[model samples]
Target: MTALSPLDKLMPRGYVRQMLCFPSTSAEVSHTLKTGLARVLADVPYLLAGIITSEDRKHVSLSECYQTLEDLYSEQDISDAIDYVVIKQHHFPPSSFAGPGIIPTDTQPPFPNPTPVFRTKLSLVKGGLILCVAVHHCTTDITGFGALLKLWASHCRTGASAAAGFDPAWLNRKALLERPDTSNRPTPASIPELLHVKGPDELTKIAALASQPSDPTTGVFFFPQKTLQALKHAVNKHIASWGNGGWVSSSDILTALLWSAVLSAESDPMSDRKGSNTIGFPVNFRSRFNPPLPPDYLGTAFIMTTATASRDDLISLSFHAGSSNDDEPLDSASISKLADIASIIRASLHSIDEERVRNVLLYLDGASGDHPPITLGPRHDGVSIVSWADQNIYGLDWGDIVGTCDAVRLPKLMYKRYPIVLPRVPANPAGDEGLEVIVSFDRQVFDKFRQSWPMRRFSTLRYYS
Candidate 1:
């Protein structure tokens, strides 16, 4: 019966779906997970509660009524969910395989009937198993969802008696909505990131655009440890020359690289003239508070920030200029350009502090009447990036039965323009440690991007739909 925060209400209308793949599959393994999930739900009953929205649809609250375990968990055969050829083609299934067949629920929000806030499905393949968990976005962000998964895994490894000491305070969601002294809070319109908030009509249009079939050129890029080190070294080397004492992390540089490539691919030199393109990313504010929020607090505590740069500056690589071949090495000028882009991203991230976070909370708290959904970035020309690299998704262990997760996947129904940077794959016997990034774009744009200098020099095309 707890009310969700304003920011929670503003989250995109859908379930946050995550797929974990394992090499082993057995009826016993499925039974253990089902029992584990039930135990976790009994300990945290709110997860089994339904979402109840206000008549005006401006507010949402968790329902007091809870559903039974049978209503929330399911088990099915892999052949009923996906083709076996897909499993053979990939050691781990790609994002395309995520669907209602495996999830067994409508992913879109405003459920036609009351449904549990969380649902789990286990699909058994010939030689493996895929566990798909769908948590309503309004209930929690990905970080919170990860915490829940970890808890469930812990319960599976250790008996329920050993897991009984779990703290109840970690489930508190209302802590994020506490209103502090707001006399000095900044106005929503005054925030640079809020400037592009779209009207309801614009949001409707965006929804329409999303419903259209995605372009066939969606795929993933795998960047190995060696490639990532080379990229970080090159970018940091350029920054060190300036002597600003400022630097960017591998995540920052990777984001910048992807942003530049996406913009370059989408830009039409024939008609796209001088203009600025923006990149928007969500910043986790869990630790930015003065006393710092609890690490285990399961709630939505993130806000979006953006960085902008002119098209010419970002697309100055030799390939964009048509002066380089696919096999040509990245020159000093390209590295310098990437360094600048990464710096912009780093600065934007640094701008989100405790004060700004409080200001955003104040704005969301005060919002009333009919207004547009907040825009993460420009509706048409910008890119929105979400990074799961820090989530440690691959580290979740389901005891000796499930082993470690082989790979993680998301549904194609997610916004195509919004690329997700997945956690680095676990080190393989070959000793390769790397990241998998999923991206989608029009045929022409993707074709150009895959052949771009960065793609050729630093990554391998792993999967495409």
Candidate 2:
């Protein structure tokens, strides 16, 4: 038998399974979930664990695969793992990102925006077709969900849970939330809006960026480990240089990098174009909500840090919040401005009364009654999405259970740069770990931005230019 991941010894050997049921069309998702899904969560990890991992471990990685003696599972375990992956595999109609949940809708949703966590779709292909289901993991963690997927995949190939000895209830989020002080919600300066609990459209501005095909404006960049190192090094230097009087947050750093790219495009002869770009980070309302967002609440824990700038605007954001004296050189001055803006926005987010966000939800929940009230009416234009994921809780042990975390990471890009996620492929059996970015844009915006930072260009450009 293959060695189990370090955390697998504590698994309870069962699964919480959700069928990723896809239909002839998208119209079937709401109809099916409304009629069938009955609980906040139906545990099924045992059944799903086996399905996702192969006996020889060639196709996937079981970061948590070996079976524990205490966690024996069988086909009977299928009923347990249903909550995180949603109720039905959602089908988007042929065009436009809208789906069947809305009125006058005859078609499925247009998977326009990636929603990043859009329904956490689960799929199993067989007999020339596939079955899918969706769930918001606000109910569990990625490790739990990944474990669940393995169970489902295992089940499909072997039909018998006896072979895998898997268990779905293996110390999941439910068990963790029960721990003391897990409610230490992050007091970050920014967070993202949960794409979940909100309606979906085919081409959300964020999705459009994430899915873009080229780097027409970024002037061909490389993202290998070396590049990542250089980025980290550059960041270290940038941070150290800005002693104080700047408002630089992680989100601010991300925004500055991407906006710089957008700014570069504004002056580009071929790709010049003006448009609004935004940045949003996820903020957990765990402390703000009633019952405190289920101790195990897993998916999309965030509020957004949204800031926008048009093509001609020279993103003069400052990092230092203190000195407005502007004694620094012009190039350094620009960076400081960003720092200041970031600090201001950070204050805005911290100031948001937790009670207010909670009240809005409570009011909506009461009006909507038992029905899930998150819906999409119309898609907004020019509002691209940017977010980051944090996974600090997966390291803890839950009495009889334990977990290992692979922290979440997101790709950053300008509006025109659609990033391609490394989906499962032949060379990548364990699958791609993160998203791949490919930048592109109108030549005009590109030209303006290229000239906007002649100072930065001369300094850093000496290396890459």
Q: Best by lDDT, which number?
A: 1
lDDT against the true structure, each candidate: 0.72, 0.32
For candidate 1, lDDT tens digit of each residue in 1-465?
A: 556776677776567788887776555897788878877886678887887767766556678756888878988885555654466466443654655467656455547445468888888876777788888888788787887888888778775635644667666666665546555555565534443577677678778986887645567888887778877887898899999898898888888777777766776757554777777788888888776777656778787888887667777652544654555656677777888888999998898888777766666677665655454333444468888887776777778876777778765533355568887776877565888888777677778788776676678887776
Per-residue alpha-carbon lDDT of candidate 2 for residues 205-270, written as tens digits (9 for 90 to 100): 448756766544432221233333343344445656767633344444433544544444333345
Superposition error at 440 for model 2 (Å) = 7.2
Question: Which residue pairs show collisions in model 1?
Answer: none
Cα displacement (angstroms), candidate 1, residue 194, comes to 4.3
Error of 2 at 7 (Å): 32
Alpha carbon RMSD to native, model 1: 3.2
Where does model 2 exceed 4 Å of error? 1-247, 263-281, 287-296, 299-301, 308-330, 367-381, 391-465
Candidate 1 overall Cα lDDT vs. reference? 0.72
> How many backbone clashes does every candidate have?
0, 129
